[model samples]
Structure formats: C-alpha cells, structure tokens
Target: MAEYEAKFTELSGFVPEFVNTEEKKARRFQLATKSFISRNFSNKLNLNVVPLREVLQVEIANREIIPVNQVHHRCKLKLEGKAFEVDLIPFVLGKFNMVIEMDWLSSNGVQIDCKKKKVRIRVQDGKEIMFKGQRKTHKFLTMFQTKNLLKKGNESYLAYVMDTKKEIPDIQDIPVVNEFEDVFPKDLPGFPPDREI
Candidate 1:
C-alpha cells in the first residue's frame, strides 16, 4: 500500500494524473508491454505461411467477401496469452486494421508514458533514484496514446509511430485467423542483437 502510493506520486509528477485506486484494482492482472528501438514486436510466423497448414481444411469458391469494417475477431499475444484481451476491426490504424483480439479486453487499452528526460521516483527516507520505464494505462485506446511522449523544459522524447494499418499484405486480409498455425519464426531476418528478456 505505501509502496504503490509512493510510485503513484512519482508517476503523477511526470504525467498530468494518476490512476484512481478503484481503477488500479480493476486492472491489476493486466500486463503492459511496449516496443523500444532495442525491442519491437515479434510475431514473425505471420510473415510466411505454409500450404495446407490447416489440417481440417475446406475451400469455398466465390464466397461473400466481408469488408474490413464489418469484421471483428479475437487475438492473443503469443508472449503473454494470459494478459491479452483482443478486439479486431476491419479498419487500419492509418489505413485499415482488420483483425481479432484475445478474449481479455481488460489490458489492451492501457498506456505507458516513458519519454521523461530525467525522472526520479522516491520511496523511503533518503532513497531516490532516476526513474525509467514509467507509464500508465487508459483503457481501450490503441498505441496512439502511448506515442504521446513527455516534453519538459528543452528536452523531449516524443516520437509518433506510423498509422501502420497501411496497405497490409493480402494474407492478413483473411476474414478469420486462428492461433492454430500462427507461430513466430525462431529465426527472423533483420533481427537485432539479443537483449535481456
């Protein structure tokens, strides 16, 4: 209880507000993650798909094509399946993003604000250190909310991500996706050096 209050105070100094006690209780189980230059998203099994992967396969010719707007589904993050609550829409972020999310929607909308130039978190008497990786969640918003980095004094680390629902591959256009055959590639091209997990 005391620890959270101290961290909350530290977070409030960097941002305009702090999450309410009830909100925190409601969201305690949801895990938050972010992509950094050192580490980005890695669901590479998405890049290449093999033929006849679906063992119980059936093909239909000339079925009704559903536009991206009319579709929504579930998705799960391979790294943290227990924490992901997904909702898919046939609309892109910048263009059109169509996909499903996992069953849990509790954690998807939270945001973390870590653009502070030099922030500090103080705990007990005579214990304070430069704080890093400080962020908060605003339930249901996309990564857009996270991109709004901090700007203080003459220093700022604000960087906007691409509205990546741009022209996506035809494969992703699939109206429905299943985790059955989807796997991240063990070895991916253009991968950076290993970082601590």
Candidate 2:
C-alpha cells in the first residue's frame, strides 16, 4: 500500500487518502442510492448524479473514447477552502464531444454535475476550471471535422442520426401545386399584395 501510494502520488501529484472499510461502505451506499434515484427520476424530477459516466455511457459512437479512470481517481483529492491552479487540457474525443483532463496538480478538488454534463475543478493558486462535455451529431462525411478543421463532401451522410424518426405533419405548410403561379392563389389567404398595398 505504501508503494502504491508513492507511485500514485508521483503519477498524480496528490497523496492518496486511505479510507477505512466502514467509510468505503458508506460512500458506496451513497453512490448506489444516488444512482438509483438518477436512473428512475432523472427526466421526471430533474435529479442529477455526480460523475456523469456512472449513469450514462459517455463515449463516441465509432471512435475510441478515453476512460474516466484517471479523472475519477484524481477527484478524490480534497483541500477544503484552499485556492489552487488547475492544469486543464481540453480535447476532442469521440465524434464532436469534448473531454477535459486535470491531473498535474496536488490537493485538487473536482465537482461533477451530471445534469449539466459538466466538470468543475479546483486546484492550487485560486484558480478554477470548468468545462462541459459535448454531444453533437455530424454528417458521416464531416464527422471527423472539428472547429479547427474543414472538409468538403456529401453533407447528407450523417454521422449520427436521431434515434426516432420525425412525425409526419398532418397539415402541410405550403399547398402542393404543379407550378409556383398555381400555388399563389390557392396557398395564400389572398393574392400577395404588391408593394405592401
């Protein structure tokens, strides 16, 4: 355990805390309760849990997604009311989504807002880092393109399509006609006034 702590501290820059079995059991029970509540009442009650990955599968559809093991492990750092500087790295992960990393500081703290899909970190030196995870659909041809890159291709090919099809409208906004001229009189309440008269 001492060697593990030394290595963890060396790699993470934070000394790990050793929790007793009773404390571990209590934390696990709390997490389980929160998970149950979030799963059953998230949409209806707007309840959120911490570390979003716990309740949702956060990853790209086709690309490799980095695991949250590091973030989860580092989040255990706690220096209450201490000002700190965070080393945050924002990168594009699967699809158009973003993942933030902060593992270069000691005695850092992290807060995860599952409802907002955001992570907030407090490091040494009175600094705070906050970021949101991105989840946007893209065209199949443009899936790999990011804000820094541009690509030209078939825009119809979708990288991610809606899970459900759009419902067909019962009434059409425009009247179906053979020609534009035919559409005018039938489609409009009255012939469009010329010059607003």
Candidate 3:
C-alpha cells in the first residue's frame, strides 16, 4: 500500500487516498474508486471521463466480481509533491481508493521499499520524492462488508437527515467555472437569433 496525496481538477483540491501497488497485475491500466470520484468531483467539466463500450470485469481479494465501464483520461495526480498525468478507470475497491499498477510504476521510475515501507518516485528533474506508507488499522465501520452482510440475510438502509440550509458557494468562486469563464458568462445575452444547422 503506497498511500499518498492525489490532486485532481475535478476534485477541486488534494485528497489523501490509499494507493495499492500490485506487481503481478498483468494489465497496465490504473483504477480509482467510484465513490472517490463521485464524492470529490462534483463538477463534470473538469473531469475527462469516457464510458467504455465493453465493460471490464475485475476480481478482488474475496473473488467478488466488479464491472468497470468508465475511464478518466489524463487525470492529474499529485503524489507526494510531484505531479503526474494518468488514466484511471472507475472501480469499486471497498476500502482502497486507487490502484497503481506495475507498468506505470516501472515506466515512471518508481521504487518501492517493502522493508522501509516507502515509495520513491524519480521526477523529470532527477529529484526523488519519498512517500511513507501508513500502517493499516482496523476501523469498525470500514470493516463491515455491506454486500456480504446483506447476502447473509442482514438488512441495511441509508438513514440521513437533510440539511436544507447548507450554504452554496458563489458561481464566481467556483474554480472549474472560473477556469472557463468564457463558457459560463456572468450575464447571458437577451437572446440569440434562430439559425439553421
């Protein structure tokens, strides 16, 4: 587990997420959690997501199958302090947030020290950024397998109280909209003349 801070324009900021590195994975493509994407990336304009025609099936630790059909291209990921552009497929990883395959690591000159629990990345400037791995701790909430529990005749329901008075950020303050100011004009013209395609 080579956890690090990842930044994304869609996310609108940096987030601490667990990144799993698998050397034996045959595929080179990386994966990001669907929950992570939905939770952080509320603005679609900043996301370069594409739906795949053919869904890919992946088996996790418990042999549960997860179908993947979306890919986020050229996503900006800031690991440690160095930035990187990567393609990530949306996945259902339970507790993990992302997966860093071996191909990407090898190509990017990333070295992992298992004994030291550190990940070293060599950047373009020949400088190395080191990320220390966090020790795994069992959290009661995270340990619950909802799907499995439900399969065993257990019941589950989402319970939440809505906060209707939550303050919404001003349109001008939105980073994504600000980036494309031309697209989202502060004031739209009265009307446009009807034109034929």
Q: Which candidate number maximizes lDDT?
A: 3
Better model by TM-score, 2 or 3? 3
Total backbone clashes of candidate 1, pairs 3 or more residues apart or in separate chains = 22
Best-matching candidate per TM-score? 3
* TM-score of candidate 1 to 2 decimals: 0.19
C-alpha RMSD in Å of predicted model 3 compared with the true structure: 22.5
Tens-digit lDDT string for candidate 1 (86-122): 3322222322222222222213332223566444433
The per-residue C-alpha lDDT of model 2 at residue 196 equals 50
Candidate 3 residues lying further than 4 Å off, grouped into runs, are: 1-46, 136-197
C-alpha-based local distance difference test score of model 1 = 0.35
lDDT of 2 by residue, 45-104 (tens): 332223443332223334333333112212222335544332211223324222223233
lDDT of 2 at 114: 84
Reference-based TM-score of each model: 0.19, 0.22, 0.47
